[model samples]
Target: MLNKLTDAQVKSATAEGQKQRKIADGGGLTLVIRSGSKTWWYRYRFAGKQKTYSIGTYPEVSLKEARAQRDEARRLLSENKDPVMARRTKGIRQQHDAENTFKAVAEDWLQNQETELAAETIRITRRRLENWVYPKLGTLPLTEIDPPAVLKVLRRIEDQGKHETAHRIRQRISQVYRFAISEGRAQWDPAGNLSGVLKTTPTQNRAAIIKPDELAGLLRAIDGYAGQPATCAALQLSPLVFLRPGELRMATWEEIDLDNWMWVVPGRRMKGTKKAKRAGQVPDHKIPLPRQAIEILQPLKQLTGHRDLVFESIKPGRPISDNTINSALRTMGYDSSRMVSHGFRSTASTLLHEMGWQPEIIELQLAHKQRNDVAAVYNRSARIQERTKMMQQWADYLDSLKQGADVVAINRR
Candidate 1:
């Protein structure tokens, strides 16, 4: 077939009156010219229907290159194949590979974990992933991720003094890789075998003022804490309730009954396997509030009466921040080494045990659920009246210390 256009004509091609014009080069090859740009197009019949394929743009794709591509398309047609569909299939395959990036793969892994992971666990994890992992390598192809790249991300967190969190993120990354490998998407775990590369977080007991006199001093400091009312209340309530910091901050008004002087934290909020929490397979943790607890909650209701959370943070619709109580402790001259928010649980458990409260009663009050469900249920129901009495007495003892009266519990009832 005789070609109607040459390399020179196509290179200098332009549209007339701002309208697009097409220059045919025979055998289904054509040059499409617009006012500002020229593009190469391959027009042919596929499945008895006319179709146009954009080869590329001018200057970028020379006439010689365009003709070669056009020839390939005709060859495909002669072989009884649709060039458009074939090219589209190739494009789609490329897109699929691109979509298997680190972020995408990690998300797929997280979805798979949802069946067994708690909702809160999943939320915090995804937040950590988005904050720590995604910005570094979220868009990279999963197969292209290397140990060096993974280590770099972990080291960034370690630099911020979050060695434990760095380790956690690394573990999550490794888990994602394992999931990928199981599905045959990845052949290697980039996050594996670098465990010793980072500093090992030390295992140690939490700092606590287990002595009554020292505990008195800390209680006085909390009383004088002139910060946000919500934060101040959290500080005061922490020692009284002795719940985990997360459990304490997330306390909802519905969970506590001032009239009955009791609080019942649901299994969903209690720490457990994701499946157990989502399925409500775990039992509730109940607390018998002292009269003092009621005094605090009564006035607190006036401040946050309309809100869902009793300890709602300054930011509306959210619970008090995870770090708020500890940050407030810092404000009152208590550092992490001196007194962390979680130390309240340690202090309460130790002193309660020392004061001659039954180990089972103390453990039950602490919501230390046994691994066996039957034992946990028995522990939950044990000593209900005595637990209520102990809470009232504990509150009274704390008041005496705060009043600057030296006192000690030497015997149990």
Candidate 2:
């Protein structure tokens, strides 16, 4: 009967116009039929449970291969391993493999950090993770990330001579692992124990300060700058207020009370020192806006006052980047060592002291906190009137130096 059922007859069971029905093959093999189609499957029972293993499509898998798969499935079935159970186990393994990809964990990390970090900081962190970490470990599972795997990525960044940025990347990896743990996606953070593993070179801090005499040269460079207008304003204002680089770039018109002659730095933007808190209202810094400074604002107000920042870039809506000031400095032929925008603060503090200006006045103008708590609180006039005068004098002093005029050096007597 097996020989009489020609291979053509067996194969034709899957052909069109045939009623869907199972055609039996010798030895537990059957051509399962449904919807005018057939597929070869092996049927057997394991421990009172019936099971079927799909071998292949009808004609594509010849009778020979079907028989071969059936024999293999049966041999395993005899070994007390049901073919169906074996197939289920293999599928589970593949599912786990799919879940362990790097992109899987990175997405988890990104979502976790979104709440705690500032919007700009989050954007930067996401960019680095996507561009640097994903390409390297995107296909790897979180459980598989080891010290070596992490080090390989950091090593690549280090090789490019970006030591500072490489340090930040390592910190980011640690944060990602922490994020994973918080989400219950990972058990441990391998990045936590990896601090001293890499050979670190000692980094010398560059103190940003411009000397008083050298300020003339710096002013000439800035005045001579034929570059971005926003940059020129930043350079001109750095000495006037000496706010932090971020606060300077992110300054909005709302914070500046020109009518009151005060730059009321909000509580959020004020430095986190005890002095900031003790000086109620963060001592709304009366900038004593000079004529030149007010002139700068008139055009800038027409330009950016409608938006959040006082000095937004020409690109529209976006605040100027933190680097715009320093980049402008570079464009004017000053290297990082030569002069930084931040260094102008130090320059003013030093020169003002040399000019016999009171330390309290200079410190107040610099937005520095008075050291003695009670004294700071009690003395509301701690250079209040004097700072207004000092600011004007300083502006005039800058103008004189810029024109190469022999300005009256501060009398330290």
Candidate 3:
């Protein structure tokens, strides 16, 4: 048997030239001395073959501890077990244990979702989890989270009059549980059975004035309003474009190709279909600018041309608040129940359809999804020339209404 190594001898051990040197500490344990490091290794013959097992590094695992680990490995070897395999198994178990917590699994799920979700969406999701889910269920094991535990958290949100937010939290929890299931951290989604359990808020359509006379009065109010020039310009352009409030508010100067009379909203900014989001293929939406729209944008461009955003806020580089348009409408005496910023879309859609514009063209111009997949594809390529004509005509029609043209009331469908 080889003699055991001493602490002084181990401290003095060094690699010779480019080769590593090993000093045996009897049995199956050996001290490997490298150029800049020392490690403890246990070697033995098992099942008619020699096997080596790493005990640990020296200084960290002293000589006494290394020998103790060697003895444990030999014990495992005598029981027909491979110590390396056992160590690996233990490591995997520990890793699973660490990752099996609800918060740990939820974080992993959120990380995976970052690639698929928008930055703003991801931020909101993280905030929701941090504020609501994490505090209650985060520390619990994935398997330990149940419906009641989740309901308790959701009920708090419900009590706060945030029924929609409570519903969203439930859905997020369900997604987290599903992710955990896929990762082998959970068995089932506890939030899956939560459907119809929470109180449902009645759907309310955005209020809009579809009457020609009322719409004309609203238009005159916007025209006469004395506000920030940019705000006034946004109010003027809103009825012309009829874009979603968020989409219009976040419009950047780069998105507009003024010379070409087009605004190409990138796929990232557009509200895509669920299928499109899943497939990671959000198509760009194009808006053909009318002459009236161009005229409105021209003056605003001169005012805020140096910035990225067309409707910039007081804070440089930031877009106006989402409530800016609605607040402006309210300032013009249109209450929330009477006219919202989103009411522009409904007003435009109603009037265009009443004007006998093709339903497909009007819907496409409104950036709504076509139910038929092939039709959706076709609509994207088709009717651009017609849409351009239709938009200019629509702008002309609005101008006529603003100028007190004859009001023809078409029956509401």
Candidate 4:
């Protein structure tokens, strides 16, 4: 019988040329040393066939442990069991366990989410999971996560006085569970049962001045805002177009058509349904600029016409910071509780609705979705003539309000 190989001998062994070499220890145990790497294996004859069982790599699996494993394999073989088959079965179970872990399944779901969600949204979602969800339930199997386990994580957020965030986290967890179920990795959504379990916080609408007089005051303040010229233009044009703050700040010159009195915001720039994103097609939102809006933008073209972005910041290439408009509003004595940048949309929605305009037409102007799929398609081009007139009328109304004209509130018909 050959003597057992020593650790020193295994470490000293190196492959000559390109060929790997193996040294045999007694009792079918072998040491493979090739290219400065060492591994242990067991060679045996079982059921009239030769079989090899990988023990583990050297240093990671010490010689004593490998010998113990080899002895155990020999014991199994004496009982007519195949050690190689046993090791393969054990390895498969470990792989299955890893795949079924909550972290593993959630990662898969997040990868699928990348195609539908915006990059910023994806980043926030991943951060939330890494911070809160993963630390608690990540190592557990997907199927093992129950409502109580989920509630424990949410309660921690609630404890921090973030009631709204707790609700949002629950929704995100529910989405992950749904994804797991669809992939056949889980059977039930524990988070679905958590409805109303968390404390409810009142919804806070964005601060906006709906009254014509107050809105007029806001317009005057914006006009007199002694800020950056680009910021002043943004504040002045915000009411005319009433776009989302991001859309307004990130506006490019190519999207504008001065002669046609139109601004075509691409679907990617505007917020839309996940279905729209998944289809890789979003209808461009067309904003028909009234004469007043054109007058304001034409002069801005003289200053920023050479650049790609209409609202370039002091930094040369980036758009104005999101805080610019809100900060401008603050300087004008309107705090967040009284008014905000997003308030422009609310201001437009309320006043336009009060002006006896058709709700659908107003919604179309606001780039809001229609009630159904058919209405959404038809309304795209349905009221262009009316909308053209309405846009001009709205602008003229703002002008009247700014001039302190006795603007009578039009009742809804």
Cα-based lDDT for every prediction = 0.86, 0.72, 0.85, 0.85
Worst 10 residues of 1 by lDDT: 404-413
List runs of model 2 lying over 4 Å from the truth.
1-47, 55-100, 201-209, 224-231, 269-308, 315-323, 345-413
Query: Which regions of candidate 1 fall more than 4 Å away from where they truly are?
Result: 1-93, 110-124, 159-161, 181-184, 196-198, 204-207, 227-232, 301-309, 312-319, 405-408
- Report the lDDT tens digits of candidate 1 across residue range 337-381: 889999998988888787788888888888886778788877787
The TM-score, computed over Cα atoms with residue i paired to residue i, of candidate 3 is: 0.69
Task: Kindly list the per-residue Cα lDDT of model 4 for residues 1-413, writing each as its tens digit.
Answer: 64477768766777766567788888988888777688988999998999898999988998888889999999999999999888789788777767888888888888897778877688888899899999999899887788999999999998998788888889998998899888787889999978688998668799998887888898888788897778888989899999999889999999999999989888778776466745644556788899998998899899899999898888898899989999999999999999999999999888888788888888887877655755665776577878888888888889888899656456423
lDDT of 3 by residue, 1-413 (tens): 74478889888888877578888999889999888999998998777888889988989999889988988898998899989889999899777766688788878888888777776777898899999888998888777778999999999999998888999989999998888778677789989999679989657688998999999999999989988877788899888989888888899999998898988777667786444656645566788899998998888999898888999988888888988888999888999999998899999999888887878888888888767756775776677888888888888888899999756434222
Please give the ranking of all candidate structures by TM-score, highest first, separated by commas: 4, 1, 3, 2
Model 3: how large is the Cα RMSD against the reference? 8.9
How many backbone clashes are present in model 3?
A: 0
The runs of at least 3 residues in candidate 3 whose Cα sits more than 4 Å from the true structure, single-residue gaps closed, are 1-99, 273-280, 372-374, 405-413
Residue 284 alpha-carbon offset, candidate 1, angstroms: 1.1
Q: Could you tell me the TM-score of candidate 4?
A: 0.74
lDDT (10s digit) by residue, model 2, range 274-317: 44445453444445676667766677677667778777787887
Best by lDDT: 1
Q: Best TM-score goes to which candidate?
A: 4
Error of 2 at 370 (Å): 12
What clash pairs does model 3 have? none
Query: What's the true lDDT of residue 77 in model 1?
Result: 86
